[model samples]
Target chain A: MKIFYELGRYWIFLAGMFTRPENFSIYRKQVMLEMDAIGINSVGIVSLVSIFMGAVITLQTAYNLINPLVPLWAVGLVVRDSIIIEFSPTIIMLVLAGKVGSSIASEIGTMRVTEQIDALEIMGINSTSYLVIPKMLAAIFITPFIVLISMFVGIAGGWVVGELTGVVPSLDYITGLQSEFLPFNVFFAMVKTVVFAFIITTVSSYHGYYTSGGALEVGKSSTRAVVFSSILILIFDYILTQLILI
Target chain B: MIQVQNISKGFYGKLVLKNVTNTFEEGKVNLIIGGSGSGKTVLMKCMVGLYEVDEGAIEYDGRDFSAMTKLERKSIRREIGMLFQGSALFDSMTVEENVMFPLTMLSKMDEEEKRDRANFCLQRVNLDNANNLFPAEISGGMKKRVAIARAIAMKPKYLFCDEPNSGLDPKTSIVIDELIKEITYEFQMTTVINTHDMNSVLMMGDNIIFIYKGEKFWSGSSKDILNSGNEQLENFVFASKVMQDLRRHLKN
Candidate 1:
């Protein structure tokens, strides 16, 4: 019953976020700033993690394919499929669920505790729309691009490891990457990225906006935002995979 | 004038305000004074539409605030500006941007006009040569002044302040209180202030409402307070012995 009540409140919060903005130009400016924060600032960590994960996937696949019956090019195929289908979208989002989610929650929660949100409310601003919508839009607009970057970097990492470690010849790895590549997989990953972006922004915002108490409660809300976003990402990953792939 | 008639508010089955009624006069500082947890903040928030009253009517001039639609409320909201206890300046924005925020969002004024208006308000609050500095870089008194600048930037017909002097030094608190009073009269705004600062009440309070234990305990101007014959009011107004002695000295 408590969970249901909270879920109901969360939906209400999201509904509040969809109200007409006071000024489109101001909102556009806000969206650009949020894009910088949510997308541009996150590029470094996303690329770094993606490269390492791709290298690990390549080496792991090569080690497991000890039988001569499995072709060396198959290593590239496995790495490409794993990175595109799962690692890029899901793992990168999980990282963002920690990185971006905590920041959003803490920032807004601090505002709430300090009466900044109250000031917005008293000024008759649709505080939810003014504060959260830009963030959500920026994330939706940028996370797919980030995931695409992650996929490219991850595949590049696989090629570099293949060349250096001789797990598979670089030429064969490139061939395997081009072999049987399904365009739908990229589309599927994008859909997941968009959904995960919504989850991270809205869920973290809900936790933040409703926060009461002082610094301690703000800290608690930040933790909850990251935890809940990561959990929801995994849950939606399964649901999306079953619906889209199966 | 702003009128709150029989307003009540509750949270989780615990009532914070109970059947409180008061009329806040325009062009003057109307102070609501109460101890901590006395529901003054909640009452002010309700009047500002930040919190919905569980019961009763809030009227600005003649329009029923509680009965209006959200779209209808925007017009009145444009006419209202509030200074928060923590100043509530946007941390991400500079003092100029913070003051210009309402105009930027709600008005069709071009950049030059907005910047000029922001500078005027900042100057009005005696904040100059600090437009580019972020909120974090300013002092507490500057933040409060910047908040006042922001609150009045819209030339609002109604102004609300929540504990505007809570964390400030006595000198700074007095400066803020005077600034609010000056703005209230200058704009003829129906200003409602929630404060427990006795100095603020004595300094600029034109009308005073006292809330005690979620109820309207007393109502009078600052001049009448010393002779109100209300023990609860007395205890609250002179909580410390030094204040009590000062009150006695003033009377003598």
Candidate 2:
């Protein structure tokens, strides 16, 4: 019950924060930082994962679609549908909740444990705006790019698998992707990434913001952040997909 | 210049601070002394808006804090400073960065000017060359000093300290206490401190407010503390055999 109330309060605060012009400067800095940490810095790992995911997803789609009598072109539809509706946004957020969510929880948890949050309140700096807004904005700005990269890589992985396994001809695979992939689907994935970004960033921050006790509590908050926000993201993702894509 | 009136706080239906009313005056070390879990920290937090009061209002020079809008409260908070029990300095920032934080966040000063002000504060706290060190590198005393410097960097009108001597040794505690006293006098800041250390109560408690089981049981000056005559106050002061012997000897 306390957590629910806090969740509501934090969102209201975050929403109200964006109304201030000073928050724009904070948002800009946060976006750049997020790009560096979430997009540029995490690119290698995300890309590597996407590459493998792409190959595996494509292979699986092909295997499921393969019928001796069925045309191979339909495999592209399966891959496209999965990537657009489920794989890219949801999986990327899962990975990020571990990496980025934990960072938010730990960083803010340490701040809470240290009384830095109190220090900020004393200094008249809205600690939430000062600390959370930047991270949230950065996540909102950067996650779409990350998902974009992941989608490309995941799809590319499928292409590679299709080529090597001799299950489908390269031209057919390329043509299948070209024909099956819709522009709206990519756009939808980007939009979903934005929502996922907001959820992970805000939930992780909320977990850390109200932390109490000492180093032990900070550790617990950080772990809880990753575990809980990841679950929240999946739940929200279902609602979003039903509302938006279905 | 801080007034807390009939403030009550409860957690999960358990009352922590009940009908607590006190005033922290300007240019004084107004100490709130109590045993562990006596709600001194909660009272401080209520006065500072960290915890919402269930029944009453905290006023800054008679201005109702609870009635103010969030923005108004934030603006008023700019005039306040705090030294936390944990000396909660930012770990990633260096000492200079930690000191300059209030300035960076609130002041219109440029980076060069902010750096100069931060250095001045560090110097005032006797941390002149330690600006580049991290919080982890500083001694416990140094961290408290740094926390003090950070608190005063803004020249806040009100300063709230929660167990400022909690983790420090006796000698260091005295030093920190003296520093707080000096700063309080120098700036004429209305300072409120929550503490349990008897030495601090004797050495620097110009005005003392004693809480007993979530209520303000006694309020008096340190000078008159020995003769409060309240049974609870007597029990608290003479709890230890050495203190009991000293009280008896002093009475003679």
Candidate 3:
């Protein structure tokens, strides 16, 4: 019953955010601020994680394909497919679920407890639209770009590591990366990234917006937002993979 | 003028404000005074449409505010300004930006005009030098004053302040009370303040409503409050020993 109640309330929240913004100029500025926070600020950490993941995947795949019968370029093919289909979209987003998700929840929860949300409402602003919609828009507009950067960096890291570690030669790895690459896999990954982005922003925002009490409750809401967003990302990753690949 | 007609509100099956009916007059500082958890804040929230009343209508001028659509309510809300207990200034914004927020969001004023209006409001609140400071950087009294400046920046018809002096020194509280009264008169605005500060009530309450346990216990002017002789009202108004001593002195 509580789950149903939350679900209904979540849908209503989404509905509330869909209204026309009272001022497009203010919303546009808000979107830019959020985009900077959600996208640009995240690049360093995402890149750091993605590069390491790429190197590990390359080394692991090369070690496993010890059979001389498997072409050396298979290392590249494996790394490319793994990063595109799973690592870039799923792992990076899961990392963001912890990073960006917690920030959104804590920021909004503070506002809720301090009556800032109430202040906005009294100013004739649709508080939900003013606060959450810009965040959602920022994530939707920017997360895919982040994923694309992660994919490129991950593949480049794999290439660099393979050549340096003698896991696979650069030419063979590059050949394998180019061989049998399915464009649809990239499309599938992008679809997952967008969906996960929506989940991260909205789920965190929801937890924060309704938060009551003081600092302790804001901490709890932040933890809940990260946990819920991570769980949803994993759930949707499986669902999207089955729907798209199967 | 704002009229609340028998409004009632509850939260989670607990009735917090019950059949509270009153009028907050224009061009005066109308005050709602009560003890902690007396539901004065809830009543103010209902008047501002932050909390929907469980029963009865709130009228702003002649329009039935409670019955209006969300779109219609926006029109009413635009004419309303509020100072929250915690000040509620945007943490990310500077004082200048906070005061200018309504003008930036609700009006098509140019950058220069918005800045000018923000400067004027800040100056009015005696916060001219703190424009670039964020809410966190300022002291509590400055934050309250900044919130008041923001509240009045839109030139609202109604000003609602919830506990504007909660954490202030007596001197700052009096300053805030006098500032609110001056703004109310200067703009001919209906100002409704919810406070437990008896000093504020004595200073700026042109009209006063006392709530006890979610009910409207009494209503009268500031002058009448001294001699009203209502037990509950006296207990609340003269709760402090200083006030009680003053009352006895005055009676003698």
Candidate 4:
């Protein structure tokens, strides 16, 4: 019952954010700022994690293929598919669900507790649209680009590790990467990235916007934003994969 | 003028404001005084449209604020400026930017005009040489002054302040109270203040209302407050030993 209530409230919150902004230029400036915060600031961590994950996947794949008849290049195929189809979209977003999600929650939650939100409301500004919509727009616009970067870096990491460790011949790995490559898989990953971005921004903003009490409650809201966003991302990952992939 | 007519509000079925009605006249400092949990803050918030009243109507001049939709209320909201208990300055913005925020969002003024207006407001608050400073870097008194500057930047016709002197030292509280009073008279704005600071009540409450446990218990000027002859009002007004001594001296 509480869950239903929360879901209903979440929809209302989303609806409230879609109203016409009080000032388009101010909102545009805010969107640019949020893009920097949500996307630019995140590039370092996403790249670091993707590179290591890709390397590990390549090495593990090479190790597990004990059957001599199977081509060594199969390791590259596995690494490429894993990074593009799942790792970049799902894993990178889960990382962002922790980083970006917590940030949006804590920032807005502090504003709510301090009455800055109340101040905006009293000024007749749509606080929901002013504060949250910019973040949602930034995340939706930039997360896909970040995921694309992750895909490139992850594939590059696999190639670098394959060359250095002699796990598989570089030529064969490249051949495996080119073999059976599906353009639709990249499109599917981007679709998932877009969905995850929406989930992260909205869920986090909802937690922050409705936050009551003081500092303790703000911290709790941040935690809840990250937790709920990650959970929803995983849930939707399965749902999207079923709908789009299967 | 702002009129709150028989407004009531509740949370989770527990009443916070109970059919309270009052008029806050324009060009005067109207103070709502009560102890914590007495519903004074709630009343002020409802009047500002932060919380919807469960009953009755809030009117700004003749317009029914309670009946207006959010879009319809924007015009009135633009005329309302609020100073929150904690100052509520945007943490990410500098002091000048904070004061300029409403103008940047709601006004058609260009960059130079907005900057000049922000500077003028900050100067009016005696907050010089602090424009570039962030809220976290400023003292509590400075923060309050900056908040005052921000509130008045739009030249609002209605100003609502919630506990303006909450965490200030008595001397700073008096300074804030004086600023509020000066601005109220100078701008001729309808000023509504929510506070429990007795000093503020006695000093600047041109029109005062006392709420007790979600109900309006008394209404009068500060001159009349000392002799209201209401026991609850007396108990609250003379709660401190110093006030009791003052009351006794006055009686003699």
Candidate 2, residues B1-252, lDDT tens digits: the string is: 888889889999999999988888889999998888989988888788877789988999889997787678887798888999889898878999888877876778888998888988888888878989999998989998998888888888998888999889989998889999999999999999999888888889889999989999999987778889888877886789988887778779
Q: Report each candidate's C-alpha RMSD, comma-separated, in the order given.
A: 1.2, 2.7, 1.3, 1.1
Model 1 agreement with the true structure over A20-43: per-residue lDDT tens digits:
668988889999999999999999
| DockQ category of candidate 2 | medium
RMSD of 4: 1.1
Per-residue lDDT for A6-108 in model 4, tens only?
Answer: 9999999998899777788898999999999999999999999989988888888999996999998898899999999999999999999999999999999
For model 2, the superposed segments whose C-alpha errors exceed 4 Å read: A1-7, A10-16, A19-27, A73-81, A213-220, B248-252
Worst 10 residues of 1 chain B by lDDT: B181-190
Q: Identify the CAPRI category of the predicted complex in candidate 4.
A: high
- List, residue by residue over B1-252, the lDDT tens digit for candidate 1: 998999999999999999999999988889999999999988988888878889999999889999888778988999998888889999999999999999998888999999999999999999999999999999999999999999998889988888889889999998888889888888788888999888898888899999999999999999999899999999999889988898889989
What is the Cα-based lDDT of residue A151 in candidate 4? 92
lDDT of 2: 0.83
Specify the poorest-scoring 10-residue window by lDDT in model 4 chain B.
Answer: B33-42
Judging by DockQ, tell me the better candidate of 1 and 2: 1
Name the candidate, 2 or 3, with the larger lDDT value.
Answer: 3
Q: What is the DockQ of candidate 4?
A: 0.91
What would the TM-scores of all predictions be? 0.98, 0.91, 0.98, 0.98
In model 2, what lDDT does residue A235 have? Answer: 89
The best-first sequence of candidates by lDDT reads 4, 3, 1, 2
lDDT score for residue B246 of model 1: 88
After superposition, which runs of candidate 4 have C-alpha atoms over 4 Å from their true positions? none
Q: A-chain TM-score in candidate 4?
A: 0.98
State each model's CA lDDT, in order. Answer: 0.92, 0.83, 0.93, 0.94
